[model samples]
Target chain A: MDTRERLIESTRELLWERGYVGTSPKAIQARSGAGQGSMYHHFHGKPDLALAAISRSAEELRDRAEAAFTSSGTVSERVAAYLRREREALKGCPVGRLTQDPDVMADPDLRAPIEETFAWLTGRLAGLLAEGRTSGELHAGLDPAATATALVAVLQGGYVLARAAGSAEVYAQAVDGALGLLACHARQEPSRPA
Target chain B: MDTRERLIESTRELLWERGYVGTSPKAIQARSGAGQGSMYHHFHGKPDLALAAISRSAEELRDRAEAAFTSSGTVSERVAAYLRREREALKGCPVGRLTQDPDVMADPDLRAPIEETFAWLTGRLAGLLAEGRTSGELHAGLDPAATATALVAVLQGGYVLARAAGSAEVYAQAVDGALGLLACHARQEPSRPA
Candidate 1:
């Protein structure tokens, strides 16, 4: 990758591992192999570089979720795929983890990507559930938007539980629980054999 | 409060705000109005003091959750109450947020309280769901342990979402969604009026 890409990539890794307050410009420079002059030449400073990195990560996260949301299946199946998709549970969500950084949350520019990414995911998930409801796949009582938000929350919260316990089993259990709730409302097939 | 209590309290605030890596011994001393000498005398160092603070926070978190988990209500009602409890969503959970801190997660001693706190919460929630199943309040298909983990995950993840979007509305939506799903499978009482 080029110097700019290198800098952004390094900043993303550092931010994910150390958070904004813990990550330093010197550390970024060293990690990216971009000297002080080159680093400045590529970006104004740490925040500028970080914004680029966060935006990139946010886009990647949204794309990943979109792929799953739009995949072929019933609404619950697609959601299950998204929830059960392999993840570094111990490492946590790349974008979701940014919420823990005080500096990232304090600055509007830094926080925008994190905010927008979730909004997009929640909206897309809602759309999928709406489709499910229209097709009579889900119970009539289910609210698409509300259920979507819960699905996203469970996935994000699963990472926290897994990381805290130093085990991914809790994450899986959370996902299974959520999917089970969704399945509870699945409409029965009109002609299927028992 | 005594010098030790002040120190622990201040450390808790700092850790919640700035995380373990961002907090410093001098900063803690300044915040607590405790002298450098007094801090060392009370605790070995920053980690020791942070451990005490984290342990205190974990205990308080458990007590608060226990109140909701054990409250007199139907299964969904209690879970909804737990999720709906007023919170400073932007600030995140004291113990859950620590899972994002590398230094805390790296040290077993520092991580112990966080781990135990979540385990306790998940187990208690699971027990509640199990009770609901036995009482015929919830669907027999509901998996108590899995659903319990999902409930805890949603709360923790709700904080992350609220903090990211800088709003609590989504948090409420997530909780509503989880509770709504739970309500879908509520066993119909033959004697209850429609």
Candidate 2:
């Protein structure tokens, strides 16, 4: 509603569409309908505003994934829900797409949110998987940490495939592949007493 | 190298480091030690030169993967080799990175090499996997095409994780996770009679 909020929202949208290098302060100002003075007053500069925007996106991403993890289901089912969650596949992950931006990766201030978001996702997934193993939902030998990394990779990499091919089917195919892999680890349901 | 070759190589390096948006003709000229006239004479402009560079990179990428694929080993071993092949993980895939560039994706000519590279790679991986199933080296029920998509996604997504985390460890972890999943589908070696 206010100048600060409008500026941050605009920057986030631009970053998703064009990435860091392609996005400019001028463009942000144009998108936000804010004057140069207003933008400078709210934030020190482009990086300052970008840091705020990235942090907000990161939190939102975490919350979205958290919701998926907490959803009622088996661990794999929850993970599938997260993977199968609707996404702008061709547009790519708002947070993951930032990794490709050299400027975003170069500045520690800019990179922190992106890095933290993934680390948290991987860790949270690992925790869920460890729980699955303990409850006999997954094979006992399955490594929670490693499998979590795989899950994260599938989501991120699926975007790459889908975007490169200009087709959403590749993204879905990749998701199916990952789900199939996870299925390999499924523990058989307990046999019913005759 | 000749002027044309130098220009292409420089464009390739610039594209990898800065992407299509960040890279410019002036930067390409500085990197290649070519004059503006020489650059224009050899190619129409940035897009023309970029196409050549991307095509070359695509070929090199194929050669690199083929080495790992064709190496002496079983199906899983070869797939593992391809996955484990050393790379500049933080820099990301030369071709895969382009998909994130709006300019590259918008221009069908520029996108051709990148799209073809991944398509060829997924198909090749699928072929190898199908062979493994036929030879009983992998699970009979495994879907080779889907598994191949998973493999490609792991590599592409692993780069995103590594770059964002500013560490190759996540990439390696993701790869290991995917490989671990593949190992689940391994058919038991036939027993020998005493």
Candidate 3:
């Protein structure tokens, strides 16, 4: 891979593992085998390089979510796919995880991509939920935006719980319980025999 | 306060602000006004000092959480009190926030207090939930342990959302929404004329 590409990937990996505050430009250079001149030539500095990495990770998460959100299925299926999509649940979301990072949180420039990523996720989920309501697939009582926020909180919080306990079981259970609750609200009965 | 005590308190602050890997001994010494010799005398190293500070934080969180959990009221009221308790929601829970630190997570000794604090919280919440159940205050369908885990996640994850958005509004909404959902199954109806 090119130095630019390698630098971005290395920064992304370091950010995911050590967070923005914990990551350093020298470390990035070492991980990518890209010299300081090459690194600076491609990007201005740590903030600039980090912005690129954060934006890329944000896009990756959105794309991954879209894979499930756009699939041919009920809202429940799509939501379930969205939650259970082969996640490193214990490691947490590459972008959402950055929110806890103090350095990342302090910089609007760095935080924008992270913030927009979640806002976009919740917006997409809310849109799907709105569709579900119109199709009589969800309770009219359910507030799409609020429910979407709650759903995202559950996933993010589930990672905290799972990681604290050093087991993905807690994360899985929460997802299962949430999916079950959503499934029980199914509108149309399957024509197939029970 | 003594320099040793000051050193620890300062570390707790720094750790909360910068996390384990991000914080340095020199920073701690400067913040505490303890010379390098004094700090070394009191702490085996930065890791030792962090363990002490983290354990101290874990205890504080437990004490703080217990205050709300044991307050007088019905299940929803108690849970609400626990959720609505004075929080630097933007600052987040010192103990809970530590879970996001990779160095802390990578160290079992560092992580034990965190795990224990959450374990105690969930266990305590479970007991309260079980009490509610035994008194015919909860739906037969809800699992106390699972529900408790969900509650903790909602708070932890809520912080994530709020901090990312730079607004406590989303966190409050998630808590209120979850409480409303839980109230749906409460033995005593919520907001009835009393």
Best-matching candidate per lDDT: 2
Cα misplacement distance, residue A171 of candidate 2 (Å):
0.7
List candidate 2 stretches off by more than 4 Å.
A189-194, B189-194
TM-score for chain A in each prediction:
0.95, 0.96, 0.94
Model with the higher DockQ, candidate 2 or 3: 2
lDDT for position A190 in model 3 = 20
Q: lDDT (0-100) at residue A71 of candidate 2?
A: 98
Cα miss at A120, model 2 (Å)? 0.3
lDDT (Cα, tens digit) per residue for candidate 2, span B1-194: 99999999999999999999999999999999999999999999999999999999999999999999999999999999999999999899999999999999999999988989999999999999999999989887688998899889999999999999999999999998898878877877322111
For each candidate, the DockQ is: 0.61, 0.52, 0.38
Q: lDDT tens string, model 3, B1-194?
A: 99889999999999888888789999999899999999999999998999999999988889888889888988767988997776777877688778789989999999999888888898898788778878888755556776677777778888888888888888886676566446545655433111
User: For residue A100, what is the lDDT in candidate 2?
Assistant: 91
Root-mean-square deviation per candidate: 2.8, 3.7, 3.4
- lDDT string for model 1 (A118-192, tens) is 998998988888888899997677788888899999999999999999999989989988988888767762221
Query: Which whole-number lDDT from 0 to 100 does residue B126 have in model 2?
Result: 97
| Candidate 3 TM-score to native | 0.91
Q: Which stretches of candidate 1 lie over 4 Å from their true place?
A: A189-194, B189-194
